[model samples]
Target: MAKQYTKNLIKREFLKLLEEENFNNITIAMLAERCEISRNTFYYHYEDIYMLVREILRDELEKVDEEFNETFSWEESLLHAVSFLLKNKKAAQNLFRSIDKKEIDSYLYKICESVMSRYVDNECQSKTIDAKEYDKRLVTDFYRAALVGLLDKWIQDGMKESPDKVIFRIGKLFDGNIERSLRISENLDEA
Candidate 1:
């Protein structure tokens, strides 16, 4: 448990700094000082800022996935996942924006795809859909990309939507019957 404690401490300090300063402005000495650990101790656990951010992000995802049980629906899972990230918005914003890191997006995508893929495996339609698992992955992966890419765009656009508002819109985005959201095309008979 000592290792876990050290890891958590490092993550906590990293997050604290994120809230107060840009990620680029944050230094190892500042992190070590904030955490009340020596520079050596900080270096002992994490090789660099990027590694620490990645570890903390991956750990956060695992904790959230475990907390929610075997929730398989993409929309429901996204609500939970986004809620978690929104809870730590300052830190996340700093990590993503300052670090120019898409690992967070990629990490979230991997978690989402893993969960959704499992659900798909169990809900195989006829012999047809089940036989096309690769095709199914393609569709699911595309949808997953859209979900994450939209959020990235929103954040990169400087958070025009709060986490709550984004969550609400995402519900609409994935509520199915998406054709309704499109402008109806007018058909002209041959003149």
Candidate 2:
């Protein structure tokens, strides 16, 4: 219990610091000082700042996944995920600016892929598409990449636009697109 508490304390302080300064500017010593723990304690919980950030991203993904399962709406799930970054705008922007682009891109890809996969599955089931596994995968991948690109741009632009409006536009644009893609893939396979 105490161990978990210490870890959470470190995470909180780290995020607070991220909001104020760039991730590269933060150090283990600074985090330790803020948490009022020894340097070893920070090391005990995380190997380095990178690992800490990775864990936070993974946790956020898990929360988004859980919420996605409950709501079964891809738009809502996406909005929920983006809302985290929106809520922590400064921290998110700082982290994005300081961290390796690959790290953030990889995390965003995972989130987009997961949400898109679920959406494709639900759409296939509802539309009675009977899409082949390959077709479904292709459709999911296409949408996932598009979604990831959209999110990457939004973050790069400092998240100026409202997430609700962005998601609503995405929903409007994607309506029936999945079904069309599936049918087209099926037709290609038949041809």
Candidate 3:
């Protein structure tokens, strides 16, 4: 429990620093001073700042995965995921603008792929679409690409619009198209 608390302290301090300066400008000594812990303590909890970021992103993505799976429909799942990101907009934006954009992208892709794959598998089980594994993966990749592109643009724009507006627009564009796309893929497989 004490270790958890210490790690959380380090993360909080790191995020505060992230918002103020570029990630590359921040260092272990700075984070340690902010946390009021020794540099050794910081290293004991995390190998480095990048590793800290990976853990932070992984934890948030896990929440996204869990919430998405718990929801009834893919649309709801997508909304849940987006809401999660918006709720953590500062952290999200900081990571987006951070030097570790690649790491953030990797985590976002993993979360999207996980959610889309589960959505496809559940839809197939419900007979919403009949698709082979390869087709399901292809459809998942398509949705993941669209989602990541949308999110990247949204973040880059500083999340100017409300979450509801973005969600509604995305739903209008994709709410029904996913199943249709999957079905098309299934037909192609059959042919």
Candidate 4:
């Protein structure tokens, strides 16, 4: 219990620092100082700042994953994910400008993939579209990449636009698109 408490303390302090400083500028010593723990204690919980960042991201991803269910519309699921980035805008921007940007990209991609996969499956079943397994995968991957790319561009642009507007636009584009894609795939499979 104490061990978990210490680790959470380190994580909390690290996030606070991340919001105020560039990722490259933060050091283990600084994190340790902020956490009021010894350098060895920081090392005891994480190998380095990068590992700490990764663990934080993984935890957030798990939370998002657990909260998502079949009942959530794709837009809602995406908004839920984007809300995290918007809430942590400073830390996200700091990380995006750092060498660890790939981690953020990976996190977004996984979330997009998960959301798209479930949406596509549900849509196919509801529409009674008999898409092949491979086609379903292709559809999921296509939408996942598109969603990730959109979010990447939004982040790169400093996330100035409201998430709701961005999600609404994507929702407009997505309206009937999934069903259309499945129909095309189904026809291709039959041909």
- The 0-to-1 C-alpha lDDT of every candidate, in the order given, reads 0.66, 0.84, 0.76, 0.84
Instruction: Report the candidate with higher lDDT, 2 versus 3.
Output: 2
In candidate 2, which residue ranges exceed 4 Å CA deviation? 70-72, 183-191
Clashing pairs in 1: none
lDDT of 4 by residue, 1-191 (tens): 99999989998888789899998889888888898999999988888887887888888888777887778788888888666788888988888778556776798898898788888888888778888888889889998898899888888898888777878787897688878988888778443
Superposed model 3: Cα runs more than 4 Å off:
184-191
Local distance difference test, candidate 3: 0.76
Candidate 4 stretches with Cα past 4 Å from truth are 126-128
lDDT of 2 by residue, 29-127 (tens): 998999899999899889998899998899888877777764456787787777678888999999999888998899899888878888888777877
lDDT of candidate model 1 versus the reference: 0.66
The lowest-lDDT stretch of 10 consecutive residues in candidate 4 is 182-191
Question: 182 in model 2: Cα distance from truth in Å?
Answer: 2.6
lDDT score, residue 181, model 3? 71
State the lDDT at 182 in candidate 1: 17
lDDT assessment of candidate 4:
0.84
Candidate 1 C-alpha lDDT tens digits along 62-85: 765575544345556666766656
- Deviation from truth (RMSD, Å), model 2: 1.9
